[model samples]
Target: MFSTSIRFSADCVDDHVWLGDLEAAENTFMLDKLNITHILTILDYKPVYNKDDKRIRLYIEAEDIGSYDLLSSFETCYHFIENAVQNNHNILIHCQAGISRSATIVAMYFMKKYTLTHEEAIEKLSNKRCYHMVCPNNGFQSQLQLYHQMNYAVDKTHELYKDFQSERLRTNYGLEKSDKITKTEKEIIDDTDRFPIKSEEKTLETEEVEYQCKTCQHKLFTRNDLFYHQQGRGKSDWSTKPLELDETICDKQVFTYYTDWMIDVFDSNVGDIHCISCQTKLGEYSLDGKKCECGHWVMPAFHFDQNQIERHNEMNHNHVEKS
Candidate 1:
């Protein structure tokens, strides 16, 4: 139990930065002795402190499980830690076990300050402790790697972030099988994310262009709903070997980012998609995702046969918008 002191002799991983379990936080004696003026807690539940305490406290509710997205808290945590360090104030970061969640944040701070990849940050942190103390699970490890690609800031609009969120939601759905999940979990899973849909009747501004069923001209999707990918190059259009796509471009599939209609087919691993208006078999979708022939991978890939659907553009959105 945290009631017993588990505070290490030296939990400081960087200048004015310390890492440990809850003991480093709840033990008032340690806080006073170490001159800790700021506290950051990342766990499944919030911890309590004295009301009259002068120190600053930031609480982020995140489980330590592999699927939970600690990535979302990167920016907020970094800001809090940086502010304390700038003021020359000592701060302690802690989680339930201090193995995954707390360690991940400390690594993130080093990643920003030193411009290091997550692995390098972990190595630096380990050297500071004189042992191997940093170990985030596979899921968090993947998120940290992505954080490196994102340059240590959360870019919700980036293709990789979008893909990460989609996969996270899908994974949550699989793990959380009960009908009555928490409201937070429900909102997180049901959200349309970047599209910002209030209802299914109205479309989004981002997706002005549309794809229609060729046989009956039934309305399908806007360009915004589509998932654009890096085209592959092959000496010939149908060559088996993977390479960059050339001028002789032949795209055989159309992919969607997300749609309300897909909820039914995606209950399992794979499902077929038929046109809503004419009931014509347009294509198929897979929750497991598939790689395009052009050598790009799409997680939870929703693919429509190019021959079965016709493109209609309102804005001719050839270039993707980045915010």
Candidate 2:
């Protein structure tokens, strides 16, 4: 006997209702095998809601549901799935063989769940579900694309602020300024400068170094000043390699070494951070130290194993040549 909550009455409309059948039994068995705890059926199409425990709830259509009609309010539907995932509910959403209506809901749900672009979520869902069905003239995909674009814009702005702060700190510490340091100071800061410093009476040269503008050849007072001149706020898209974290290090030092924003961009590759602009080599000086030659700021070059670094260099070299 089918419960009213999980059965359909044929006397009403087109006699579309479920009876004890092999296909229904097979579908139930498939759900069981997958360990699906619940199923929600929409439209007046009634199927047995045979589910494990009380975790599953089914809602039959109270009225005619159309492809163009919103299942729930657009905002409510988006938030409902988002909150369900946040609360750790493993929901397997379906509707009528997992195509059309169900696909629409699930497609939107995936976008909200994983914070993925509409195209990305749709592609993934299509791959997972052979149904791969999408409703034509659906605005959900376009709306989700707008969301992704907005997030990308915000991230870029935040990165710009962080880069500005790093430059300020470098300037304050005289790293980008004050080239009048003694030979001893020079040795302390950078040990690899091949040119020998000539100074009389142990006094460093107080004269400022002149830097010509790359674009206009305009004489600038300092290399640091020319840094501002060389800058025109162009975007730098560089490839990154991930590195292992030294968990033994103090948390404060680790935090200081890495920025909160960079941690996300750094994936599992090997430690190699190249300048997105000029492809010049980069290293971590301070939290504020990793500025590139193209005047774009970047995170420190994470040192991975030698083999890993070599692989990354090879990959980067290929990428640069391709571009």
Candidate 3:
């Protein structure tokens, strides 16, 4: 078991990068003590920090789950770390805990950038940090393997393409008419001619039917939340379907729900919302309504974290899938 008391700060992976937990990321004192110049937070919620001219922060909206399609963010995160290192800044990569999501990303970075095999990259990370804690979950491991294999295939194809071009040039110039193409080269050329290599794009399909608590297997929201905005006028009144909450079912244990008047005066909600049955954190309740990035005003009743909740498909009600 991982103990927060044992280690809650950053672990240096190299001169440029460090892996840490939420506590270290949130605490300015810790960040300053470590001389961390840049921070990369991969979490569901936005990080709250004081603006400082000396420090830079990057937030990637991510969930700390095995099946959260973290690979989709891999390229973006890798480039960010690369830029930070090139600029001679020490960067801290963190999630809620530094055990899984963040660790997986660091390992993938090494694998992709350094051309290290998955095992080699993971071993290097473990040697630098806590070996016991630097473990990616099974789903993350599988995805990492897939990423490695895909890259390997692309690299090999490029190499073969180069060889094929050289052989064709030699034959065309009559330098070696008797020279024959190797079986592998012939196959590669044929395949390349038939189907060109394209970049892989990851797509996230939203599960709009039902959202359930990860801990208790309790249904939190149904299709009722999916609706068009009644007041908006821009393109469409279709508000982003946030998990609509009934005051009776969800308990305001994490954050208390304030009335409309109180929210306007305070400029923020008082507390987070939680599941009444298990007291699991569901989300926050914004009484005055929060503006989304897509230019729509949504009443933040319960913003469910895709990592913390399991989504149930509308077509298959019995099967539960991870978001």
Candidate 4:
């Protein structure tokens, strides 16, 4: 009842039948002449269409999955094979060459159903199916590596990638706010508890802390100093606001106080800054680095590292002024 056959030989077993090419004609002729009734077609990639026959069921296999998003596509094909196997349905699995992708899936089946290691299962499939089938480079190597490490490693390396992704996001520029604003259950509960107050309360209810105007040249850091500067009460180190502002006001006075708010909240210079544009860099940049002060799209935050902030400011100075 069991029989093995290679009805048609291909020029290069890189993938499934080149269905429309010259070789496809040869393969189709062979399939017709041989009366291939119960073929288990194994394809490494997409198969070429031959003469229309609803009777023949085909199974396709991809050589290498490029990324996590691709895993679902391969899993769907694998699930189809599983269902066919359960129903005792004859199938065909083909790749561009029948070497890597087809062989990998067969190997996976052996591992999943028979509890074989990747090496052992691959060896078994190559021996029984096609000895030439090998794990060649493309994207399959990374996929197989992921599979292998997940299968055998003491701690799953896949989880490590997940953790690394989280860390990358956490450390990326201007993402400190993003780190603080997460969607965890505990955080959700805390946010929910503060919902009504958050929604309604505009004025921040906080114990008065000494905070000087960040916009001014002198490094003042107290509320009393800030009040003194505002009132023009004592000898001010920095320039004082002009008492008269009927119509002779310059841009400096108007922009000074707003500048303080910007420095406190979104100053790229203050904190660690990643390129808010790319969200790829680590650490902080200047407050001017915030929003790229130029026209370039960027995020701003307090606590940005001085270097990045300065760099961003220098790079985008022209555009920042326009913005």
Worst 10 residues of 2 by lDDT: 10-19
Model 2 spans with C-alpha error above 4 angstroms: 1-26, 44-53, 58-67, 74-89, 130-323
What is the C-alpha local distance difference test score of each model?
0.71, 0.36, 0.58, 0.35
TM-scores vs. true structure, each candidate: 0.55, 0.30, 0.46, 0.37
Q: Determine the backbone clash count of candidate 1.
A: 5
lDDT of model number 3: 0.58
| Candidate achieving the largest lDDT | 1
* TM-score winner, 1 or 4: 1
Clashing pairs in 2: 242-270
lDDT of 3 at 219: 71
**Residue 259 in candidate 3, Cα distance off native in Å:** 44
Query: In model 4, what is the error at residue 64, expressed in angstroms?
Result: 5.9
Worst 10 residues of 3 by lDDT: 247-256
Cα deviation at 203, candidate 2, in Å, is 99
Model 1 misplaced regions, further than 4 Å? 1-10, 174-323
